[model samples]
Target: MSTTPTPTPIPTPTPTPSLTLTRPAPTDNPTKPLIILCDGTWCGRETNTRSNIYKLAELFGVRIGARIQSPDGVLYLEGVGLGSSFLDYIFNGITGQDIAQQCITIYEYLVHNYTYPTHEIWLFGLSRGAYLARAVAGMINNCGIVHPLRIAGTNEIDAPQTRLLCETVYNLYRSPYATNAPHAPQSLRFRQTKSWPLIGDEDPADRTAPRFHPPIRFMGLLDTVGSLGMPEYTGGVGLDWPVFYDQHVSTVVANVHHAVSLHDRLFVFQPCLVSRDHARHCRRDWERFGVTRQEWLPGCHYDLGRQRFRFLREFGGGWLESLLASRWFGFASKVIEPNHVLADLALRWMLLAIRAQSTTVNYEVVANIERVIEDVTESIRGRAREPGRTGDGDVYGHVLSYAPFGSLLLDVVRTLRGTRGKVSALYQLFFDLRDRLIPDDNAVVYDFYGFDEDIPGCVGDLARVSERRYPSKSYVKWRLRQ
Candidate 1:
């Protein structure tokens, strides 16, 4: 009787795709971590000629519409809808849906269609696409908290968007998963976008507050200003684009908090340059609104897309090699310069630290400075050592590459201990070096200081800039008195 009761066979349970999806293995694994890329609207439809999709294909080791698996067991889903066309990016951009909403739809579509292993899911985006990346990453945090991965190494490279994204994601994770684990630090490079204040506007009121503040002004300042301001700083100071790139980049690397793991290989490049009208106004905003100038890398926004791949590799490394190394994203570098007050404060701290790092101006410290100088020189040279020079052919404009020296300065400052006193001059020296590095072949000098009343073009751009005002020494002194 007992045996008869056990004779009823159990029915087989249907397997869940989510459950069945195993993490992709190191070699020949079916389950792969999915990588979703949302292409910018500007990726042109003409001849499939524009967009970073091609570079991405190379990076992901997969052809278009093919499931490419990496050694790390990640899956890459390429998001190539409309390239850089006006209808795609600007007018009907993301189908009039805010980037965050659009991103959720894309993620849902991908998740339903594809088998994503429980392994890490990554999203790579460019320009407008980054909005999606930011949004989707936020959603992921909303869903659940992932624990600490790992953190190691540092880099000083062009692009602030990368740092910001990393920071933003870190914050999201920190907010949600703070009690459990800290998220890793990651970076994405944002290219310079067109500045506001529109060209041909003479009145500062165009950028100034209307009735104390306008919604557009408030939102734009809070949202786009930080990410969009980098070019202004590079352009305004006439800094060597490359050298300037190298300096602050290192600082970004240093500031990674312990809670966040670092993404070592992933690099995001965005070099956004808009229409002449946009560029003009962006420059104007620089002076009136105290906005940073625009740092454009010649070529149309679509054409410069290739430069993103460059950032993934060593500066001299060809785009493909760099692309190969980057598992998540790629594009030309762009960034919103940090707030002036914060930057100044950081500069002061670094200066004091540098002096503290070296008790005396002995050979060691001097040697270190010289080494920093040489490295910076090499970085600058590497940026334009080729026959192309800084700005070559029709794709022409000044490019300032300030690497190593500026980068090293950040590292020195970050590690330096106690400070002797305020050394504003040290910060000036760094900025001055960047200013001197600007290539002369361009149509105009990128004036950072706004010292050039004679420069007509840069003024308009300066007027439109929206970064936090650098409180004058007098203002600081006055505040202290109160």
Candidate 2:
């Protein structure tokens, strides 16, 4: 009877912490920063154009030296631009097969080489290369990176199967419906079955969501132009090529720095401006965590990226060729030479941006950037001190004093079209016709940052001078309402 009244209360059981799979913690090994440089259309390391992307790669190689091949050193890869070869150039430069193949190649490299959580990925590109860089980042966001060990799976024979699985992931990535939802069933199942475990905390309630990995550390782009399938000659074409709509600058990238050409007015080379909402979101993130900048700088497409035609060097040598190479017909050099200074300024700005993120990059890269900054600063100061020089006079003076042959050709076209030298009306007619024929969301008007905004501190003086320089008259005329 007493035992029944004095019975001890049963003890409450302590719950054991639930176990969830996660990416392995980064080891003691130093981070191996993977730098991928994508060149603009028809540009590469071997090309005479030598875009900023190429130069940056060369600089990284020079600085990294033997370490580039070491496991602990920076990993570097260069994607030859879209139209780098004759065969590649045959399909209007935006062929889906070429782009998809390039993306796959880069993806394969990451799968085979990248060390999850211990390696950083950085991207640098110019023009269409910028578009390609964004596409690669988008692919990683849509399809989480596969574990390198899982790719080989303790045996070499599994490579083909791994590759097939990679293709499957990419095909799923290309599907709009699969990526539109945060936890699309198909993508989630694929990731859970084929890729590495999600890198962060897992939520049991939302287990179906696909979690991406190996965030892009930084992306530096120069004038991203996403006019897919728009032929260079016609400016608009209704081709059914795969358009990369997911390549917009987004938060998945820890940092983004875009150097835009304030004077690129070609209907086919319209500047791809970041959306106002995205910019604001990036600004908020910058205030709290990282950096994102889109700066407008002086120059045309080639002027900003630095392209030199190799036609004469490639095929000119005979007496007839010499005549074409003479000063009167030396349009190739004249077209690109006067703009080098402005291009260098842009390069300096980008190098400074890279330097700012030096913790993730090689120390030698930082050193090379400093040296470049010194050289460019001295050049700008010397030019600025010239007796008759003021503002961008040295850069744009040639254009004003002596128009290039292409300018003369465009003038002739304008006169033939009966525009009576009204370049704005001529360009307006072309744009209006393009809009009417194949109206597309990608055909949005160009929106540029004010010349005075977002100037890098290192290039502040030079930027002011560049701002004074006159932009392309035609570009100024074609500045459409956004």
Which regions of candidate 2 deviate over 4 angstroms? Answer: 1-30, 62-97, 148-154, 157-161, 178-182, 197-214, 227-244, 275-287, 310-335, 359-365, 383-482
Estimate, for each residue in 176-250, the C-alpha lDDT of model 2 and write its tens digit: 674533256655665566555443334456655433333577789898875444332223433223354654554
Off by over 4 Å in 1: 1-31, 44-53, 65-90, 93-101, 113-117, 144-482
Candidate 1 TM-score, true structure as reference: 0.27
> How high is each candidate's TM-score?
0.27, 0.64
Say which candidate scores most in lDDT.
2
lDDT by residue (1-482, candidate 1, tens digit) is: 35545577876554332110121212322223344555543333222332343344334454543233433322333333322332333234323234433544544433333331222233444444544444444334232222222233534332344333334433443343434221232211110021111111123344332211100110000001002112222334432222111111110010100000000010112222211222223323222321222232212222223212111222123454334434443223211121222112112222233334334222221224434434423432233333322222111111112222234545665444235333432333222211011122332222333443322222213322222222112222222444
Clashes of 1: 75
- Lowest lDDT 10-residue stretch of candidate 1: 217-226
